[model samples]
Target: MTTRHLVDPELVALLDLIPATAPSAENLGQIRAMSPRPPVNLAQSSTLSVSERFIPGPAGAPDVRVLFYRPISAQGPLPALLWIHGGGYIMGSADAEDSLVTSMVSAIGCAAVSVDYRLAPETPYPGPVEDCYAALKWLSTHGDELGIDSKRIAVGGSSAGGGLAAALALLARDRGEVSLLFQLLMAPMIDDRTSTLAEPHPYTGEFIWTRQANRFGWTSLLGQEPGGPDVSPYAAAARAENLEGLPATFINVGSIDLFVDEDVEYARRLMRAGVPVELHVYPGAYHGFRMVASAQVTETSARDQLAALKRAFDRSV
Candidate 1:
């Protein structure tokens, strides 16, 4: 079926604004130009205060930039969220997501730190993930100074950032470095193999984030061919053989998203491994359907995500 017929009508109009040509190695600049830039006046709440600072990145690597959002009225040491922005691992910056990150702080009354990790093609697998891990470590050790409750920390992101968040959870578990209270994986790009598949579910991958773009993203982030035998779980969480020790997870994906199948399977694996898991699959929604503010699904997605984060924070406390 065509994307228009399969996707939510509101999402269909939004998707129509973008050209559908697949990104390739030769047209990186074209693809970057086509991607969305953060708006000058992001819709934000007055209850939140925003700040930016540089923090220690990976050992020997340069410093990572982070944006902090906190409820102005809240007292010290509140729950915190470490956010990673998504642009298929190759594009996007922390500042691009300031609106959403700040809204999260206002809604949950929690402090949020959005990581400005090094993008791929320049900094691949280990570099991006390590930068995120460093940010997580920084949040943990310096929670007191940052007015965050060390014990109530959650890691989350959208699309490629969600993929990194998932990978970070695994890295934290394996390295015994940080204890994450929860994970919010929103339309995550978690499987390099997603693009390698010989065939996809008939209804998926036709809308925003097509199969061609997915392949480009995975390749860019790996700095090598993706879906090979030697891929690391720290680079792609779906590559992890075990999901037993990860924190409580919230997985949500649009029915028509390219990553829907992988996200659902990961949630199933997390549940089977005895980890607490919450999964939501919104019907008729395509990739980033939540971006259309007027769509009913967008409101539902926001409500569900906020509720999940609140529950995670409350339980941690």
Candidate 2:
């Protein structure tokens, strides 16, 4: 018998609001060019700090940007999350994820430092990873002003952002530099090995993040052809040889996504290393299926992710 996800009814409205295939470079550039740069706006339920900045990137690149989100009307140190926005390391900007970041502040009631890492095919391998690591290091070093609880900090993101967060965890561990409390990896694209795309994905295969797009994202970021020898663990978190001593993690993926198998495998490795791992897989949902306007799957995915993040925050507190 097939199983059904406990989907939320409101997801339809949210998904319906997204434009199909609108996250591309041309579309994103057009939107940014036409619209005025909005402040870090919050929902009615949230109390958010404003005056966000796009400081010089940690990677020392000119255009590498980072946005800091602090909870307003709150006091003292709060558990923080290093939030990364997903656009296949190609097109997304910090503003593309303000709503989600705002919602994260509301749900977790914690300060979130959202890093706008450099994209691929330009910055390439180690670029985004290094930039994000720099942001994490900066946050930890300035925990007092940022109101962050250094011991309770976590890392999280969606899609490629999720992959980066996972990679960040490993990088922090390998470098023995910083500590991470938890990892929230929602539908991450971690594997560069294209051996698992046996069936055509129900979404984003021919739409937004096609197999070709995945190839480009992986190859461009790695700075060498993907599926080759000497792939960096920082470039593809899935390539990490050991997951021991890593922080606890939560991963959610769609069964119809090309990344499902690799995500599941990554979780397995995390568990194998005695790191606590919680995984959720929704059938019939494809890559970025949650972005499909008005889909039941999207709402369920969002609510589940919210619950997972809130739970993670609750655990640390």
For model 2, residues 96-202, the per-residue Cα lDDT tens digits are 77878877787767888888787776788777888888888888888887778888789998888998998999999988889999999988878777523455434
Residue ranges of candidate 2 with Cα displaced over 4 Å: 1-46, 54-56, 195-207, 292-294
Q: For each candidate, C-alpha RMSD in Å? A: 2.0, 4.6
**Candidate 2: worst-modelled 10 consecutive residues by lDDT:** 1-10
lDDT score, candidate 2, position 116: 78
**Lowest lDDT 10-residue stretch of candidate 1:** 36-45
TM-score of each: 0.95, 0.83
TM-score of 2: 0.83
Global fold similarity of model 1 (TM-score): 0.95
